[model samples]
Target chain A: MKELSVKELFEKKKKDFALSVITQPRTLNNTISEAQLNRPGMALAGYLDRFSYKRVQMLGETEISYLQTFSDDALYERLKEMFEYGIPCIFITKGLSVPHQMEYLANEMNIALISSRLTTEKLALNLSQYLRNYFAPKRSLHGTLVDVFGVGILITGSSGIGKSECALDLVERGHRLIADDLVKITLQNNTLMGTPARDAGWFMEIRGVGIVDIERMFGIQAVRLRKQIEVQVELMPWRDNMDYERIGLKNNWSSIHGVNIPVIYLPVSPGKNVSVIIEVISMNHILKTFGYDAAEAYTRRLKEEIKRQSRRNR
Target chain B: MQQKEITVTNKLGLHARPSALLVKTANNFRSELHIIMDDVEVNGKSIMGVMTLAAARGSRLVLQADGVDEDYLLEEIAKLFESNFSED
Candidate 1:
């Protein structure tokens, strides 16, 4: 199971959320196994049934005000009961002061008590967004991801098959390079988002030229941070007898992280401008998205012409 | 087809230079070669594909070759890995 320690969350979002450690700092190592945060209103009110102890608990203004009405001894008893469930940690939103009794029991129980200055709604919204992304499924692929006219094309092929060379050519023609060599893909909300490997930066390795920095050579406009992988273009060595895709009547799809992306196999050979072909593919893809398929339209016209010829013969 | 499981013993693993050497050796034969690591298989004759494996020291890889010269292809690839791609 993927778990994030409370220390990691605090360290990562300390500046963004205006967070601070309230209780014993030693308890910050508590692991948060769930991405959801819970408001322990019912538990604080002495109802423990169906309590989501696995999630990080949040105490907003409502819960804190409720505890404010109770005596210190009564508040300690109430908090002690809730902490017995082994909850991950608690966040006090709105920069609220941590009650003496609550902090005492939290330290006694070794559960982290954190405070954030953001409003309750804003804190919950931002924290949930971060948590969801932290738990997303990720994979790395050996290919070049580029943004071609707003369409993300992942260029993949064997080693020395000119994938990088083709991507560089596309960059020269005004397309943006997202990643080269290793593309880090994350599945977020059913979309396969492609980004560069953490260490790859904006570099491309050409067979003869070694390594070249794309951003430095082509400027900032020639590269992007991440893009949605809408299509895949696989370059293969051209063979004499290979029957390639002559008509685009059928689409080939590749599934990654349960998302299906359209794939195009293009054969590479001497003197073929693969980059230009990729641009055309991107434009055709955009046209298809707008309900215009050139191959299907051409086939329809051919069928009509054949019908006309048959009628004249009859 | 010929297959062999080899371990990457090179100190730096299969970085750019080692991957290049491995691909160069694999291309000497006419057989189709594939290197499988952790269920992800890639073309062995492609430098980028081999580098993508990122097989560090002590990583295990399965090398498979198919064609009339499959035996020779596997032998050559196995020798490269066994020698740590000629890196100390």
Candidate 2:
């Protein structure tokens, strides 16, 4: 529910975007709820049916040239209707001259009008990417995230369940550690990226062994700033009563912020090398992405052999 | 369990593309697929594992498959090796 004001965005991105305000300075206080930008070509062309008021509108060459077709009176009326919709801000790209009527109406309506030297495409791409991170939904998870064979695996379990210990083992094996203890995850472009929480210490606490700084201990190659999480590995206490998946014939998934990620459960018991298991899981994820499914292959072969046996008997 | 010994005839042995193709073809069954070369045995369904075999041209590998379609899986793998992973 956080809001970004026109003034903040302009001030933050001015250096990179070279943006200059064209309307009254106070109009920069207007806020936009959406992270996405819109080029309201249709709205400027007298089509207000799909006008979005909560978007940061951009005027490119096409829109500017189209507005030139109208007489001063017609332009004034059209722009008036458009600004009355309460658009958060307008950006004229490619250093285009803001039409006199447009600038006059922007000031009259108190809507912040801005100009940038970049083309519409470059500005839109940059602004959207920047805004996406600011507006993305995020959550902090109690887990360890590691990059195994280029796959991001989030290890989650109860406290003192050896999450950090397993991560250490993987790190020793050359996999990169992203975040230990507290993983801050965010959904970016449908991919879940995880980072270390600002408050959490860079070191991980191991019972009886104490804290270990992964970067200091393993050098720069063993730590990562952030990673796109591809799988979730949950460590559960082993129980004789529970039936764990032995064949991995069916896939399991966990959802965070509506993004579904593959999940695997590894039962923790004495002498079980959970770190190696996690590494295999990461490798398996890569294989699956390349259209290889060992479990499905087994089932398919089973069905084929069964059919062949029945045919031979007949 | 089904097992077969096949020599890698491809000009490039098992490089990235061939290893990927072999892994893809190996995963289409319900079985534990393994590629054995000398002292090492790696999961056939894993590209990294398969690459670890480092099977060069003319290197013989033991293709071991355990599950229902073990025979079909081995046969398909054999066909791929025979075709040199389709890289003439």
Candidate 3:
């Protein structure tokens, strides 16, 4: 996620951000709003959504503003013509003055009136990059990731409860590690991806230990740069008083952002080998994806044996 | 027509560097090159197909070559993969 202000977004691009594209506030008679408004891009795209029009306006900000140079009446007529056909947002570079008339009206119409002190080239580069992001496909997720059985296992938990320590144990098991703690996951185009923080890959600072690197002693095979995260496992402190998913018939799931990943729940007990269970959970995920389900297979076999015994009795 | 099954002893399996090297060696053969990882089989030319298998270190992926120079192709492919995907 890149955070960019409207002015920062249109840094140097002039062709698209000129007055001709800006949907000027309709002020046939009087004054309007005070604060500046940043409008969504779709509003601008809607301005040119129709056909039978080809217009290109070059917004050169460094030039002495036309508003300052031309007569008030002449500028008014030019501004009116610019908006006559249908316009989007008007971007002014280097923080030029926006006559109170345009600003007030722009705010009312929900048109973005942006300005930046950046020179033309800088503004152009910035605008191009921002536009790229405007069209890039994306989805975000909430989970913690670690390498298990050569697969990235994203663990989801409610706030805090040893998800990091379990990942640390898995890292020590000679399985390469990916991300720990907060895992910033994203779907680029359609492929799922994840990356551990620069200083955070194998290091676990669990309240008492401060920092522990899963590499130095475990060697290079014990850590990885990035992995296609394919599984999600949730850890909960063991609750003997509560019920756990036993039959595996009701099937459970946990979604990270919009992308739904395979989920498995494991109750954490002091004596339980969580790392081993997590490993089997991942292998089970692989099996399920390849059209084999252990639970499903068991139920089918049980039904067939019941039929076989019934036939013998008949 | 000959088929050979060689285990991917390389640390990174068939990804990036190894895929590039395998593709280079496969391109040299007059026989069409194909790789089978478990039930999935794909052209040796496609790097994505080779990688999607997610065949980790020590996993075995079968290689098959079919042409008049099949024996030469098999031996060369074997020799190329025998060394871990390392330049040395």
Candidate 4:
């Protein structure tokens, strides 16, 4: 199917992204998706970041009566100033009757006015969750994240594949360990991010070693609270039949949730340098993301030399 | 306009990841895609609907996509299932 324009995509998903509240308006234009969801309890304020454009401006309607004491025209002018700043939609609480003019303006602007009868605190929790999924980034890699050699490497493989051991080694070497085993990964915006358990910190449970706490042994500086999982090091069993990439040519992207994070297959061998290989892989991924392809560069250089040799022979 | 039945051979079954992939692929076409499992017809584009069926590995599913691109869409899905569902 053809790709939809940003406006079209927004149109389909905007309604679901909202909390059911009544519409209020300032102008009769009925032209904009900007809205002012007013709630004196200030519940939806938490979700204001992603739905930042969907202006659910929290205000009590009684406050409007206070402004009305000044003059009808003055009250309208004041509300207009608040709206020009920006709003996708607005929900007002207390179920106060909206000004007839504001209602007409909300309908004209398409600023979706929602009046939730719930208390501000209750609506905040509900609306925050309602809007969270839309703002939350999908696609997260499950692995122990470590920043080895200044590279964010997420080590993944079958359970009991020495993933914890490799991370512990990296930590001992003065590298930072983000999470050891059962990393909590989440996406905010488009980036694949990572974090260790708040309670456990970077402690890892190796079958033989028991729960060896890395932060205590390696110091706080040796651990990072969170890191972006830039590179994936997938540990696979050493199988003769399984085809491992001898040459790093085409890249691999492991789909998490919906986002595909770059993945690398690091076959677990008896004495392979897992940490070192993973570090190099991360650096290589960073380089590639910045436009340097190591394999392609090598191929190009080799081709140049071959061409030079042919010219000399001629 | 076309309909065919095939077995889901993926080891993980039609869980979150597979269901999402199927839905995303189906959404890319104009055909109205539906997956029938255990005599239950479910919309392929609805992630929650397709997931509710819980069709695991070796589970037979009837697929039907009715639209202008029905034939082409079904062909791609049939090939995708045949190539990637079973042991490679």
TM-score per model over all chains:
0.74, 0.70, 0.46, 0.49
TM-score of predicted structure 2, chain A: 0.86
DockQ of 1: 0.01
lDDT of 2 by residue, A1-314 (tens): 97898899999999899889988899998997899899898887788988887899999999999989999999999999988999999998998997899988888899998999999999999999988898999999999999999999999999988999999999999999899989999999899999998755468888898877878889999988999999999999987545456557567899998999989888999899999999889888898999998867754554454345334434
TM-score of chain B, candidate 4? 0.89
lDDT of each candidate versus the true structure:
0.87, 0.86, 0.60, 0.65
Model no. 3, DockQ: 0.01
lDDT of 1 by residue, A176-233 (tens): 9999989999998899999998765698888878989999999999999999999999
Give the runs in model 3 whose Cα sits over 4 Å from its true position: A1-143, A158-160, A190-192, A197-201, B1-88
Q: Give candidate 2 regions above 4 Å deviation.
A: A199-201, A209-211, A296-314, B1-88
**Over 4 Å off, model 1:** A69-74, A240-243, B1-88
Q: By lDDT, highest first, what's the ranking?
A: 1, 2, 4, 3
Query: Which digits, one per residue and each the tens of the lDDT, describe model 4 over residues A50-130?
Result: 434433455455554554454556546655644544555555555666676566556655555655566556555655543
Q: Pick the candidate with the highest DockQ.
A: 2
For residues B12-56, write the lDDT of model 2, one tens digit per residue: 667656776787777677788998988899999887688666666
Q: Please provide, for model 3 over A36-105, each residue's C-alpha lDDT reduced to its tens digit, 9 standing for 90 to 100.
A: 2222122223333442122112234433354566566655555554455443455555556666655655
DockQ of each: 0.01, 0.02, 0.01, 0.01
lDDT of candidate 1 over B1-88, digit per residue (tens): 8888987777667765677677777777789999998889999978657766767676778989999999988988888878888789
In angstroms, give how far residue A262 of model 4 lies from its true place.
Answer: 1.5
Model 2, chain B only, scores a TM-score of 0.97
lDDT of 1 at A68: 88
